[model samples]
Target: MRAATGLWRWRHNPLRRTTDLAEAWIAFAAAALLCVVVPLTGWAAGSSAHGSLQRAVRTQQEQRVPTTARVVRQADGPGSGPRTADTAGEERLRRSVVARWTAPDGSVRTGTVTTSRRQSAPGDTFPLWTDRSGHPVTPPMRAGTARAHALIAGLMAAMLTGLLVEIVRRLAVRRLVLTRYARLDRAWAATGPDWGRTGTGS
Candidate 1:
């Protein structure tokens, strides 16, 4: 805002330096890019990410099946400890249990599965996700989760775009300032020896 105001105010000002106009223009350009390019970049990134993730979700849903597995017994051994479920939705601690279930091919499959049920015992049935071959797999990604990830990706892209624009603007302004200083230094050097002389000027 200040930059835009200065640009308008200095347009016809007789005392406005070239560097001042350049700086104001740079600021205006940066602001314009921030207003236009940043949101567009973010939306593009998010839309792409969302499309890819939705495709993955569909593939996972088709390849994975949710089946009920009956617990045979608690699996307490050297390798069996409190662990996390393979599903992305389940992040809490779960107990390992020996369970049996039928595969998509109608074959009986028995294996060690992780469950959040603390009081798991024999014959306790719980939902489990498995591949077509009956091997346990993680649950499919939820739609809400995919959307949240897309939103985060969009936000990150937008912030990065804004940051890049600001960086370029600052670098250009810094260069202009340095050039202005160099010109001032040259002018000072040319007149330094003649300063305060009695007849330096007519």
Candidate 2:
């Protein structure tokens, strides 16, 4: 009887509910993890990956081309540019140039064709550019790398965590409702059937 009464009072009094507290705590924790921890860790990891790629590119370029050469004729613009013969009596220079980078899986990838006013002949060699720290600069500002992957992972984690937390809160609310209903059922069952009773009733 006491249990049923207590359950009934709890159901009626919204202030005594446990679901609200659980939901609030879950939301706060999730917000903190997403807005703070995840982004910081991802940023740190991405910076490291960027630095590593730069170093690797520089080392490879140095070993391949030890000396730099000057261009005699400027290359034409864009696609289908006319090729020019070298006045130095070397092989004709290629009008178009492509930059390549190796991925983590040891696969080589070529970037977009960059046509420079300075032409590069087939036999001519030039030192690849590097920053002060000897790191090759990757072109196409919008390109993705390991750093981007890390950031995307972080975002997915944040969203999943929020979803799980909300699910738990909903379950808690359902359990509370079920427990209250069960008590009400038991209370009504104990009262038994009440036939019509009154002084004037036949």
Candidate 3:
């Protein structure tokens, strides 16, 4: 109903110009494409993202192994404890510490790791993640995280699809407007100097 009302000029208007009908059709078609293509594009993007992230999660879980990191040295600053306000008995702790852990290949890997343990001393153990190459890395992607990423990708795809459709509509309208102006100019030029010679009907 709303679409019909919007295109009424092109549907049943006797006074509508050719340019008006063309513009109306272009707008209508663009609107339709935007409604359909945008969602499909969004779905494709989201599905691809979800699938890729899921694969990454699987690979990470399969190849990577979890192990404990042994603290080799305390991180920079005061006590390796949580930050505190009172300086009397309270001490600043560095959550991050230099630690070493055995890699999947039995090689030892050492790096700074952030932990929640307070005042942890040398040889203290902390949980950490490592990749197949034995390099320390962040945790693997979770299903919820993948879904969130897919949502963001879907929104971006939808926006880009709509933007492209609008550009096409704008270009079509601009061409029609320019063509109409040119025709009007040519008609004015043909009759501008011939009005006074009406007596010479030839």
Candidate 4:
């Protein structure tokens, strides 16, 4: 905040180093950049995710259908179905049961389907999704889920932007400090040892 207000520009101050002014300016620049870059990064990431997810939702809706199926028997879900990640990048496991359903062709088909219930009884009706081949598959993605994915992407992008900004700020400050120290070292090398020796002149 002090840097944002240009306090280091007060020329009357006797305690200021060139490095101090340089760091102050750098701080101001870093703050300004953070304000702009963070939001821009988030928007870009969110928009890209939104577009991709929206497309996925449309595709799934186009190629799939929601239907009801009767549980043929209690069964274990496939251990290897498609894996989807949440915002935290955790894999969500799907539960399932053996079920039978009538397809678009009016023929009865039997297959394993994802289910929400931990225990299901045979002949109990449950919701399921079917692909073009009438085989049970994952449900179609919804717009709400797509929006959630976009939000997560945006937040992650914003956090990464903040991290980058901090790293750059630290590097800038370190560079200025090193430069100041080098200048001091050079000045001392030229004058420190010869101060009292006096050989040349007083």
The residue-by-residue lDDT of candidate 3 on 70-175, one tens digit each, is 9898777432222334322433332678888899889887776666687779988977777778776556668898889988999999999999999988998999
Residue 61, model 1: Cα distance from true site in angstroms: 0.7
Q: After superposition, how far is residue 197 of candidate 1 from its true place, in Å?
A: 2.5
Between the candidate structures 3 and 4, which one is better when assessed by TM-score? 4
Over 4 Å off, model 4: 7-18, 76-96, 194-202
TM-score of each: 0.90, 0.35, 0.75, 0.79
- Angstrom error of the Cα, residue 36, model 1: value is 0.3
Selected candidate, larger TM-score, 2 vs 3:
3
Evaluated against the true structure, the overall lDDT of model 2 is 0.46
Deviation of model 3 at 165, angstroms: 0.3
lDDT of 2 by residue, 30-120 (tens): 5565567656655665566666655655554443322222333333443221223432232233244544434334444443232333646
Off by over 4 Å in 3: 1-3, 75-96, 102-120, 194-202
Q: What is the C-alpha lDDT of each candidate?
A: 0.86, 0.46, 0.78, 0.80
Tell me the lDDT of model 1 at 170: 90
Write the residue-wise lDDT of candidate 4 on 1-202 in tens digits.
7676665464446878778777888888888878898999999999999999999999999999888989888666552234455311322334567788888677899866666766688878877777777776677888999999999999999999989998999999999999999999999999998987787775
Worst 10-residue lDDT window, candidate 3: 79-88
Candidate 1 matches the true fold with a TM-score of 0.90
- Model 1 stretches with alpha carbons more than 4 Å out: 77-92, 198-202
Per-candidate total of colliding backbone pairs: 0, 0, 1, 0
